[model samples]
Target: MPRGYGGTKGVRRPGVALALHFAFADLWHDRKLSVLGVILLAALLAPPVVLHTLQVGLVETWARDLAADLRNREVVIVGEHQVDADLLAALRAWPETGFAVPEPSFFVTTQTARLVGGRGSSVPLDMRTTSPGDPVLARADLPPPGQAGLILSARAAAELKADPGSEISILLQRTPTGGAVERREVILPVAGILPEAHWPGRTGFVSEGALLGFGDYLTFSSDTPDYRAPEDDERWQSLRIYAPEVSQAPALRDRLQNAGFETRLMTDQVDRILRLETGLRQLFGLVLSLSALAFVATTILIQWLSVLRKRRDFALMAVLGMSRRETATFPLVQGATMTAIAAALALGLAAAMGGSVEAMAQGYLAQPTEIVRPNLIPLLAGALGAVALGGLAGAVAVVRLGRLDVSRALRGD
Candidate 1:
């Protein structure tokens, strides 16, 4: 008998502490069984951890890559329409709207431009209106509003042999109603160069104010001495609308369509990505649920069997004056300790498996990005759940311990 089991009041140990000591000793005495239980539990836990880590990492990485594509979140007006400031304001007020800029007619927006100091034929560049928060220019330096500055796309810059700080001459030609053709050349400094991934075609991005001014110049006679830009109430021919997130693009597109606006969006791609993510989550949830159930069942069965085998030992402890509460706590403490160790082992195994998968993806699959990274929150949560479930399982065994016939068990009946 342990010294603390039936000790005098002066030397008596705490009930829980004494039970913990006996639990550890009992586990050590049956070290092989304890080790086997830990191995079995770890084996059950590791696969789900690895699967969840990979699934979350891969899906998150894919979603991030898709979301980074500005085109996926853009809703382009199909053709020329009389878009107005009020409409633009209304669209901007929508929670789903990330950015909305009115555009001039496509006929007036395309202009022949050439570098002022370079020797290259003039190239017809499609000018797009941009504002401060334009997603297309997210990585490019935006020109100041109302300034004669241009941000040229990679193709436009290449064709003009121009870079940032270079000056480009935009030749604006328009035939006024029942009048001869009018031509005007405007030289603007290149503020920045957009990456090819942002705008691939031969395009130039100018401030909305600048585009409006150019449209006004082309629409009216250039000979007017007091050339004033169009008023804010002036209607536009098109609009460039963007959603803050790709998931919102479909809804925004539907809203525009419902309002009699024809727009184009990558809704099919967005829907596919969304569906994939949802399906993966559901599948992973089912797998995790089954795994957890199996773990609980195994823990309860194994711990109950262990308690049944040690019935006489608990009976002997009761005979030695140990309280029933203390005796019942033995299996609970042992189960918690074993499960804690198993959780650690499972985490280690998951890390190893995840590393192997990541290595394979990097080396042979040609995926350089991390695709099996484990999130700390989920890992900690899983570990805590395992320990809690293990305690619950042990509690079930403790219920059986309460039913033990002390005298009969001690008599080896």
Candidate 2:
């Protein structure tokens, strides 16, 4: 037995004991190989994992409700003032018939004083106080009309520091049935705030009838005040659309185009997101392919060399009356044991680094507020699989040891 060794000759066979000693010593003596395996594995796997997780989360959490809104988001062109029954039916019967409702067109925006009541003061804060790129939220989340309700985006609620039952006064840009942009304020109790989305802009909402005379608020209008040039001629600049699915996008666009209705894809819609997701997946595949090549090369070369270096030691085991199986087990055991330790270290490092990556991506990629969780299935499977595979591959070198001419080898040594 060697000095300071935990076990002695009487406790275990010399070959197995020696194999165990070498196994634990691999990391301490071969530190570079340990680090290389972990680095290559993490690089190969992280990006796609993070992206897939976030996308899955958004679809499940936020998009479940938003799907209906986007499906019905489309533009309707009517030269005359009224929406006919046939036109309404035609829009609904479109191939991707997600949303068939007609949005009333026309509205007005004006600089009006709003009494955002926590203190109930009528001192108006002009549009300047609104968050940049502020859009009016749909206050329609209430339990249908005739219910007292007001709506605010999560950002607006924070800006106004408002809560349920708080009163808010909103003034539209104009009244319905055509005319000059006018001012009319309506007071309604704040029913709830919209769910927090990653978009930083602010939003506010009032009930469908909260602002009397604004029929366009419930629908769309050709005369929406393009806040950019309020005094300019109300040109045919903006439109709304209700596309059902991606397959219908081209046909629907064509339908509107043939009728001289100018249409555009609202990438704010998920189709744009789907394209972005495709790009990310391709990038992930590229990264993994590169890293995997490096990992395979490094692992095979280093391990194959390690086995060759231990040939002399293995010959000594064969000289000691060890069977062929015992001889082969020497390096297989050592490689498997080393892999176990490396996997543990890699997993810990990945867990720590994954959170930082999610935080960086949240705002950059418009990801959900939560971090993408690591895929435990692949991680575990890979960890176990790699160790088993390396152990098996290393056996080729060990098997050669059993055929060594022990007496001559020992004498030569």
Report the lDDT tens digits of candidate 2 across residue range 179-270: 55555455656666666652233544432222323433423443332123122222222233455554455467677767566556543454
Winning candidate number (TM-score):
1
Tens digits of per-residue lDDT for model 1 on 235-302? Answer: 89888898889889888998988878898785456667777788888888888898899999999998
Clashes of each: 0, 19
Candidate 1 Cα deviation (angstroms), residue 251: 1.6
Q: Each candidate's root-mean-square deviation in Å?
A: 5.0, 9.7
lDDT of 1 at 327: 87
Candidate 2, residue 121: the lDDT equals 36
Model 1 quality (TM-score): 0.77
Backbone clashes in model 2:
19
Task: Pick out the ten consecutive residues of candidate 1 with the lowest summed lDDT.
Answer: 221-230
What TM-score against the true fold does each predicted structure earn? 0.77, 0.57
Candidate 1 local Cα displacement, residue 331, angstroms: 1.4
- RMSD (Cα, Å) of candidate 1? 5.0
- Local distance difference test, per candidate? 0.81, 0.50
